[model samples]
Target: MTSALPTRRFGGFLFDMDGTILSSIASAERAWTDWATRQGLDVDAFLPTIHGVQSVETIRRLNLPGIDPVAEAHALTEAEMLDVDDVVPIGGAAEFLAALPADRWAIVTSAPRRLAEVRLKAAGLPLPGVFVTAEDAERSKPAPDGFLLGAKRLGIAPEDCLAFEDAPAGIAAAEAAGMTVVVITETHGHAMDTAHATVTDYRDLAVEWDGASLKLDHRI
Candidate 1:
């Protein structure tokens, strides 16, 4: 027998762009791998670390000599913007998002605004009215800044929002912002090790506007 579906409700929703709503792993990995290789960094090790964080943060962490983190990050974004041939939405993501009230949802991503727009368009996803990009926050995921800003933009309290995320840093950021999180594991090769709710994708879920908030049900 199949397990019972889980249901939850919240005042609004905050979404992480890359791994949660869509999968840009191919384009992202290609860009990062090339950049890392050029920097004499271990591509295998570096690629894994690039997800869930801003490109500038990743480059800044390397402490590469004579490198401008901002400029290098911009270069990386330009490369990714051009390599969207494989960009696609997570399972049922486009439809799920279509059902949501535009004003009740916001996208909070570690990607810069232009890069975020490029990937979302490539994946054929709707552009949200409130998009909180990396440049919108002083710090990236694990800092709660971006998620917090998203909630603020939606006119909802941080604790009243439900966040969908796919990476460890993003999950942490949502929690820090005092919101419940639904982990999207569609792109992950392995099951996520998370205590919060988890789903393979939006296919198994249903969402409705309850006049006051969104009622989400995930029946696996």
Candidate 2:
């Protein structure tokens, strides 16, 4: 007989907000476009690179000489929260999350905490028990700081956490933090070789509380 449940258990889950759990690309693009236009920068050039990184880092990367980076980031955050009409959860996201123990999962996002919360609420997703945002880390995605900090805050060891990501930078961050990654394809196309697994939607995944711990199972 085959086992009905997955055997491997994880201490906790680390999820990326924008593309992994809730789909917020429209709101993000709207805010970034307005910011880029106001700053007289190349919107086409900058938009592609900002998806998985922190807004402050993106501002720095743009190297705008006159704008105050901190104030600019704040402006962007306010803009993001103002227009969340299109924000919604990815397929099966809510159901999968509802199945897990609240303490066993958290969100690690490149968005500032306020923006993250706004988007989550707009998308009708529950606020996570532990939330890690751009303001919580000295560095963002592609750096291990955010993910490591999130795992630490969850009271879980780095290696025991499973991270779900939708972009290359997030995948790198999770791996650098010593956690295995499950690459969700809501944003990225082909799965990176570094990811432990890949899924097009949360439909392929299921989480369960196995009495003592939470575990994840996938179809492929």
* Cα TM-score of candidate 2: 0.90
Candidate 2 lDDT by residue in tens digits, 1-220 = 1123325788888999988998888888998998888888788887888889988888887777887888888888888889999999998999888888888889999988888888889978999888998888988889999999989989999999889888889889998999877777765544456425667778877676776667787646
Which is the leading candidate under TM-score? 1
Estimate the lDDT of model 1.
0.90
Name the regions of candidate 1 deviating beyond 4 angstroms.
1-8
Q: Give TM per candidate.
A: 0.95, 0.90
Q: Considering every candidate listed, which one attains the maximal lDDT?
A: 1
Candidate 1 — worst ten consecutive residues by lDDT sum?
Answer: 1-10
lDDT of 1 by residue, 157-195 (tens): 998899999999999999999998888888998777778
lDDT of each: 0.90, 0.83
